[model samples]
Target: MSWSDRQSPIVAVATAPGRGAVGIVRVSGRGVAPLAQALTGRTLLPRVATYGPFLDADGQAIDHGLALYFPGPHSYTGEDVLELQGHGGPVVLQLLVARCLTAAAAPDAATGRPVLPGLRLAQPGEFTERAFLNDKIDLAQAEAIADLIDASTEAAARSATRSLGGAFSHEVNALRDGLIHLRMLVEATLDFPEEEIDFLEKANARGKLDGLQAALQGVMRQARQGALLREGLQVVLAGQPNAGKSSLLNALAGAELAIVTPIAGTTRDKVSETIQIEGVPLKVIDTAGLRADHETSDEVERIGMARSWEAIGQADAVLFLHDLSRMAEPAYAAADAEIAQRLGEALAGASTVIHVFNKADAVATEAVATHLAAPPAPAGQAVALSARTGEGLDSLRQRLLDMAGWQHQTEGLFMARQRHVQALGEAAEHLALAQAHAAQQDGALDLLAEELRLSHDALGRITGAFSADDLLGEIFSRFCIGK
Candidate 1:
């Protein structure tokens, strides 16, 4: 929160630790020109790569590599920066870092100012944080830097890149700009109390609010898609033993990830696979089957069932699979009904539970028809598919994507975290409230102004035009060290 904390010169290992093709010791702050001179034994030209041996405190060669210097105001972090690109060996990088810190603490011969003292090792995401502080990039772009680095799928990576390039921020700022203009119009009219109504009517405030709402709805829809990319969806595959849970898991993953067997209770533990469904990451957890009190006797099976319930509790979606082949048996139907009851109770209506009737290929035609006519799920939509034959899987995939609020789009998606989505939702709420105030019978200009301000603030938080110190700390703290 202090000026010294954000502006202090910092150093870090910019490359991954371990023997890579090369490593870089990055330094950023004021007086980096002198710091570079001290380390390389030669003045580094701005934005130029000069080959040299990185020097120690005693002017000895530490390692031969390239030294690049970028002067302040036009570089990353908006500060004078220096990079010592050396061999990927760990010791050499550490030695270079030590020498920079030592130089920073030592006073210069010509000038009384120390080379660049207080240039300590950077905390996690300090460089990107500094960039944000210096106006080189906004907070959303700063977050995108981390998101891009930690992307789990190609789609996620691309969206992160788009966000980093300001696609998402531009849209939000445009919405904010519109809101600001409207606020200005409304508040300006407040000064002329007698003509306020006439001004609002001429300005068409309601129409402008409606336009803003339309824009916000579009942005929120895109943000929801982007959120799906970021958080993905966790789906748990659960049913009775040998109800084709493992078969469905294998079919979805397109691999033999789970062992299939004719004997009941073969899968006594959970098997998981993360598959991309139309570019949306879907984590499918195949859990051990639930059993009635009299059916499960083995201790291991009990433990597995406990774990199955635990997984179900945490899932975003629950695929309650049923074996259609056994639908004619009353005991089987009773057991499934009991499990469904428990699922309804355990789920608490948070997770999207889909009652999936599996083994359609192996079932009799009449039985499949009857079961389809009267599915047993009390709280979820029903899906019928054959795991072994891979029938109706496309529809299942589409259903899962739909449950997660995923909309298939080749473009226009930028990665967004849950906070971004929440902020947008709040902004939308305020916008709607502003419209409500404006449409009041007597009109409430002051209240309308207040609502518009709230909407603006909410949108501002997305780009960090309005942010709390603790929020910045939390956002940057999640980044990996040296980012």
Candidate 2:
């Protein structure tokens, strides 16, 4: 539809609210030029910023500022656009908006339509939505616009910029093309009994399936890493009493964020700190030490341990700490073996664990070397470090960054939300189902096609190509109104 024919012009403050050096009031759609002309008392040249007085109905200047115009199909929202850059006072900007609204609602002769009869202030992201509808950008790129706006870190911003540049859409489109080819092959095999090639019989069927799965998995991993970079990872420190868990927390954060003591169970609660390792955000938790005794009437201790277990279950990674120096200390020597056994069982099913041998500064020479040579825990994959002295922290930091799947040279990475991850996961699941269906004898072509279609549509929703109206509302509502 032509910009002029669809509704009327929409206006909004494109700048942040409140006091600032400048505030921009933006209007787009058929009435933009007419609105500007009415307020400025002159015609606007395309793409040019003109010094003008924004005037009201009585020709009284509301605000003196620069006015810029972008004619339809070439501007943001692919509509005729006008921008009034005025002083940032809230009251003054409101008056400026009133002046434009009044002027834009005037009648026009050429189209025999009211210049802005149906125009109203835009809802959040409406202008961007109009731009998408007008084919200014695809859905994925449109979402990237919001990502770019909300990006919290430099890496995230760069990734969003790349997605806006079409990196993400290109990958999805490439995968879709592959799915199409596979579907075509399946269809051909079903329809042509005498066809020279049998797709199912071809040894390459398995290979193709493997390749597709690998590609999807790789993309999923990268997307997940991107999501983590955007959202951060939650890590919980869990271990027996006096395992140096608090010390490790402080070490990782490079701050005295948690209290540390030689006494058993000094920390009867959870302490959390946000830290970044190589720019990868982490929510690090220092939890109460895990113990099995119930004789003591410490309800808070029980609650803390329960909360720690909960954190462990939810964590992306766990730091299961052990005090090497303490194992040799007479006070802890009697219980060392029991604690070690418990530690092994506690961390057995963890998604990932870094066995940390803390208090390296005081360990005996031979014992220290042997422990340092050994892994972080029973797994022998541990790092021996003095959390108090900050020794061996660089290695631990690198390991955390590696776990985050971040490379310093992040060229193609793009920030994604957990919602995007879930959608991609669903798409991947459907594709696997389709592959399995295709592999079956007398395979259900209809089922395979349906699954493939669902997969494609899921990918489309990531970019807004297949988004529901409500999803758009949810996404844009989170944005500042001025955005």
Candidate 3:
């Protein structure tokens, strides 16, 4: 939206659309006190909730509720804000919103002019976007607001709350401060060309750079974990028909989510479920059993197989299941080998693969042990588990966590998006170049200063100290209407 558009008084139903005990209609802008008085038919005490009726233009009660007024420079968006809490029936909320617009546009009895001019409906995320623009919150904190609302797990919600509370912004600002200090030192050395090396050495420029890099690494590690929490791992289960893929999924989820049967093509589609391990969400998918084209003459089964490969290509990891009981069958072994070869080719090292030998309870212990010792595919970790009996599931879960790089360290860790991770990575790259320049015998002060400046900017983007308008729009646009 344009700058002036954002400046217009905006109103929206702040509560979600549904029938509930209460709903809220929020209005924010300059000179909103007059509008509040017009709506409530009395002056509202600033920052105090007054129980009353929300009146219509005809001077009649539309709804009995609570009204709160917050004056400019002291409210959420740094603008005057008026909130009306009423019954949460969808129709009632709509009427209240319409009433707000009507009240804002009506002529004032005192001046015969609009009570609040330029009143309009708020766009999606406009409320929170205004908070960011007004300095009430930084970019990361603003993002965290949406993250907290959409969090899928308790851990994710807590981390998002921390970020919204400025935990992430605090760290980014600290790094920026360090970078600024180092830049000042390097730039000063650039001015004194003759004594550049001596000045840098005396100021301990290399030592400062080393300290900043170490701190950056620490933040990067935590940020990666936070990102993992936000975007959970996608795990797809693959194997020949009826190789216990469905059973394994059901066991891991602790519920019957997919159909398990002895039929080779019982599952002709993808079945997905999100299971949390140590607060980390893993979306496990059971796909149609992988098999040779000639083995499945049915068109539906062939289509399912095609989709299975497509999912594998997009998965973060693949579980290639092997039937332990069928290992003695020559045809079964050859088919398993063919499927393994196709998996390696399809994944091409893009996704991690875990060798899972299933149905151990149905086979001899020695056979299971021998197969585990020498997995058909020696590419990744192998686990011999009986899905029907729930054996060895814990080991598989731990291996998945290890592959995801989760360290089980949650204290002080804030929620982060993929973009935050990328920005930190870029900053680290710039710092590495700066370090290389500082290590030279006759270090180039100007080059070092430029690298530090670039790194500083990269970090600034995280907290919005340096950000593009388009970036801000993109980030806020994802939020639901009414924030």
Candidate 4:
């Protein structure tokens, strides 16, 4: 929806859609206090939780709950807000929401004030969108609210919290302010053509642009790390049948999530688990055995093998497991070579391939040394581990983290989306063009000014100062209702 369109009061069940000990039905926008009183039959003091029975159309009690009223200009969404904390039954919570809509529609007999006609069910992320439009929070901070709720790891949660508290936006705003200062100087020099060159040179505009470029690079590095935490690596376990793929899956998950057996082609399907390394989530997918198409004529095994190849194709990283015990067998070695060639072709330059040698306990140290010393894979990593004994698992875990490019502690990180990273890159590109224009002995003043304006516009997009209507809609549409 357009930002200029007037908004009406909105209501929804803010809690998860299930039974719990307690649930919340929230209302926000104009006449929230009056609506609260209409349902409660008592004046609700601002910012206080008043306990009472919520009445229906016939003054019959619908439910007992706590009614909290937050008056306008100080509440969430920068409007009057009310929350009804009630029992956690799905029907009970929905009934409370129905009561809110009904009350918002009813007119007072004495003052002839009709309930807000616009009061209705809230759309997904509408509340937060209202907050952004009302100046209660900026666009980045609004996105953080959803990010904080959807965080899959402790590090992600902490980083999202930092962004919600304005860490990311603060950095962007500071850079924007510095850029604005430089733009003012450049544009001001254009008005007087005589001293323009000497004026820009004397002002050291190039030096200031260099400093700004350095600062942008620093923020970009942190943002890249934060993006990794939000969108973690998808690592798939691929190898021949009975190659200890399931055992490695269990070891990484710290549980027997997949069945382990000695039977060839035991795992005729894919089993997945999510594990974390240094608070970065890794979705580990253990696929069935990879073999020649005709060798396993069993219909199920053939399908499983095809799926394994499919998973390898889309993976962010592939952990190609090898059984060390079979490294010396001539037939086994030939099959291994065939699989490696297929992997090289399928993955190409798209994914990182890590060579993991499993069943270390079954082979001697000298044998492992001779095996690994042969040749390295094309890319990614190579490590040896005993999934049964849990040896070298630490090395594997750290290797996955390195592949994901995760760094820094929670306190030093802030959550960022891919869009934010792309925006930063666009701004950097514009700034570089501006720098080139400024460096010329007799540069066109108009071109230099235009480049600076473009850079400023790019930076402002992050904070909603120069955002488009469709972009805002796309962003808020991802959030769940009543956010």
Clash counts for all predictions:
0, 7, 0, 0
Better of 2 and 4 by lDDT: 4
lDDT string for model 4 (1-483, tens) is: 643343777898999998999899989887676787788898989888899898998899988989898988898889888888989999999998888887777887667777656788988888898899899999889988998999999999999999999999999998999899988887878877776357567878889889989999888988888888888888999988888999999999999999998989889888999888888889999999999776777998888898999999999999988899998888777888889899999998799888889999999999877766665454336888999999999989888877777664667788998988998999899889988988888866688788878888888898899998889889989999878
Clashing pairs in 2: 139-463, 140-463, 375-380, 375-381, 375-382, 376-381, 376-382
Backbone steric clashes in candidate 2, count: 7
Provide the overall lDDT of each model, using Cα atoms, as 2-decimal numbers: 0.88, 0.76, 0.91, 0.86
List ranges where model 3 is wrong by over 4 Å.
192-197
The prediction achieving the highest TM-score against the true structure is 3
CA deviation > 4 Å runs, candidate 2: 1-9, 98-115, 184-214, 238-251, 254-273, 286-313, 328-351, 369-376, 405-409, 433-448
- Pairs in clash, predicted candidate 1: none
Worst 10-residue stretch by lDDT in candidate 3?
192-201
Q: Against the correct fold, how does model 2 do in TM-score?
A: 0.78
Q: Provide the global lDDT of candidate 1 against the true structure.
A: 0.88
Writing each residue's lDDT as its tens digit, candidate 2 over 396-463 gives 77776676666655567876778878878988999898888877886576777778778877877887
How close to the true structure is residue 96 of candidate 3, measured as C-alpha lDDT?
A: 92
Q: Which residue runs does candidate 4 get wrong by more than 4 Å? A: 2-6, 111-113, 195-197, 376-380
